[model samples]
Target: MRYGLAWCMSTFGGPIGQALGLTLAEGAYAPVAWMLLGACWIAALVSFLDGRRRRRLLASQTGLGSLRAVDWRQFEMLVSEAFRRQGYTVRETGLDGSDGGIDLILQRDGATTLVQCKQWRSQLVDVRLVREMYGLLVHHQADAVKIVAIGNYTADARRFVHGKPIELICGDALLAMVRESQAAGTVSKQTRRRA
Candidate 1:
């Protein structure tokens, strides 16, 4: 019963599930339940594939102009997908809202790295943001902290991160990562096709 409730909630939700909960258990409506579940799964697959396509499109574009053009959410998604391709287990934190705090938690080789995505257009990432991330790093005891920006970092920001377990990725550096991740995805797809 609990599992049925969970499935109904996930597949239909709210009033629809409430109305169908009894029907779902009825022998006559078993086909209806299966059909609705199949539809839900298909929608999920399409949504996942579409998001992958959008991430690939974002990665294939060259230069910071393309990066800055995406909204804050898409920018974060692009960064998350890139790191995932680069072998990190990425978790989107959605902490401190959409535009601030640790936006991603990356795990690789038993080490956890917290990431902050800054999609600033004209301004450089300043020391204040770096300092805050450092504080988070210490508090969370993460292996490292990374700040990914569409623009460059300020001199103070650069100085603060030097010799620390913090990596600042911006401008050309970020573009290189995008390109590398994009290429990695392509190679894997080709390999799978050939296999």
Candidate 2:
């Protein structure tokens, strides 16, 4: 918005100035237009690079974006990294192999969120899993519960959390997060540290 508005102003201000009988220098318009164009170009370049990095992050999550191809561990790591990119300090609790239902804890803006990364691709994730995550919210003292599933959830699963603080992240929603987190940072699958 910043650069775009500058671009519009510079591209039109000279003509408007002329119409209003403002005596601007002849060479003024070109330089201002060039400057505005440069700024817009830079913003465009930055946006493009950020978008490309985010796409890469989303694609490599499942090794070419196929959810079924990824193991549960990789999916969990991907969710953690995604949260990390979104300015959250993500702590991976699932690595201990006995996390008691919580996989990742995301802390940001003085709020804590518990995330359960469920890569249940073979079958629909049901209400039991959602209930387990909800139950941990009080035990862990978390502000919210998020179930990040690579696959879809059962209708019962969705209905269980209606009017609740539980957030269900499926494939499309996860991709949206990847896009929104572009400014956060790029994540390399190989160098993605556990947790």
My TM-score estimates for the predictions, one after another, are 0.77, 0.61
Sliding window of 10 residues with minimal summed lDDT for model 2: 19-28
Give me the runs in candidate 1 sitting further than 4 Å from their true place: 1-36, 39-43, 95-100
Clashes in predicted model 2 = 0
- Model 1 lDDT-worst window of ten: 21-30
The clash numbers for all candidates, in the given order, read: 0, 0
Best candidate according to lDDT: 1
Model 1: per-residue Cα lDDT over 14-36, one tens digit each: 77776566555553465665888
lDDT for model 2: 0.73
